[model samples]
Target: MTEPLFKQIAALIEDSIVDGTLGIDQRAPSTNELATFHRINPATARKGIALLIKNGVLYKRRGIGMFVSAQASAIIQERRVAAFAATYVAPLIDESILLGFSRTDIHALLDQVAESRGLYE
Candidate 1:
């Protein structure tokens, strides 16, 4: 199953931040703008934006829309690491163990894969 729409919306904003499409200290798109762009409800867009604000990835200006926080990129990177570990590493470890692979075996397999992908120097 896919993530909830709000989470997807939040991820989209975080992705923009990570990719430098939305720079820190820049005004974020309004809730209505996001709603229109994604064809989602205003409440859904608001919830997504609110999540970022609550997590210190964004800040709201009085009478103005939200702005990207100075720490937005770092916050998004931290979230991405946690998401990666949960979504990929945990499952991979579990499946590897189920397949009778030891910790060292898993490490070696991952190293081999990384080398094959030219990720290792």
Candidate 2:
């Protein structure tokens, strides 16, 4: 089970925005609605929403509701890519070292896979 409820919520919301499941200028679900929908606490929902707001993914409209920012998808994508690299790469490097693999060996294998997949840079 995922332990970080707020972070999981944040990722779901961010993915919805980035993938156009949620649209620009569209009002997001209310905190109470989100809480109910995800079976989480209202405060947890608020934390997720607050993170998006701080990251410029959403904005409040006084007493109306929270709306997705025009640049929400872009911001979410940037954040996701950054987080993916940090989350995966550091652990991968540590694991490779523990498995008796050198950095150069890993880089060569990564390049091979990238080239095979036509993702080489």
Candidate 3:
């Protein structure tokens, strides 16, 4: 609960969209459905849905319900990549440079770790 419940709700839905659990144009669970499932207030769930709508991750279908946007996965991926770079890569690079590590050193270190961890397919 480091973030607000509504934000957590939005992230949960975004995770599903990004992981292909929820495909493009798929109807997202309704506000009531989420609220019921999570035992939260409907208003809180609506706030989460509203945040997604504002971000274009989800779109309303008039009288129907909210659906995944065609670019939902791409949008989530782009945003997440930028966030990951800012939060992790940037700091790591700055620290590595301060510690006298060159760009090549960083690349070698990363590759070594990736190889050892079976991260490279």
Candidate 4:
């Protein structure tokens, strides 16, 4: 599925930081660079970066520029993992029971997934 422009941009920048394209203590691109690269408004770019900052994924360096937080990638991963559990697991479990699938059925499906994905040993 395609992501929205701002979200795509945010993910790209975040991934860059995590993968060392943007290092610790290194500054992120200015809003203008982001705007030009992504063909978006500077305001939009700023808002996207602001979202990361709000989530503790980035931090300002005042007179310098934005830097990846030491814990930024870990924080982002944790948030995403929690969101995934909420979005996928809780509802799936509720629906499975409502549709008469028991815990055994769920465990069986999980085992199938694990085996199919080579996660089972």
- Winning model by lDDT: 3
1-121 per-residue lDDT for model 2 (tens digits):
6658887888888878877888999999888999999999999999989988998999999999999999898888887789888999888888998999987999898999899999955
Which 10-residue window of candidate 4 scores lowest in summed lDDT?
Answer: 1-10
Q: What residue runs in model 3 are displaced by over 4 Å at the alpha carbon?
A: none
> 1 or 2: which has the higher lDDT?
1
lDDT of 4 at 17: 76
Per-residue CA lDDT of model 1 for 58-121, tens digit only, reads 9999898899999999988987899899999999988998899998999899899999999977
What overall lDDT goes with each candidate model?
A: 0.92, 0.89, 0.96, 0.85
TM-score, every prediction: 0.84, 0.72, 0.92, 0.78
Model 3 Cα shift for residue 14 (angstroms): 0.8
RMSD of 1: 2.1
- Show the lowest summed lDDT stretch of 10 residues, model 3: 1-10
TM-score result, candidate 3: 0.92
What global local distance difference test value does model 4 have? 0.85
The per-prediction tally of clashing pairs is 0, 0, 0, 0
Runs off by more than 4 Å, candidate 4: 1-4, 18-23, 117-121
Regarding TM-score, does 1 or 2 come out ahead? Answer: 1
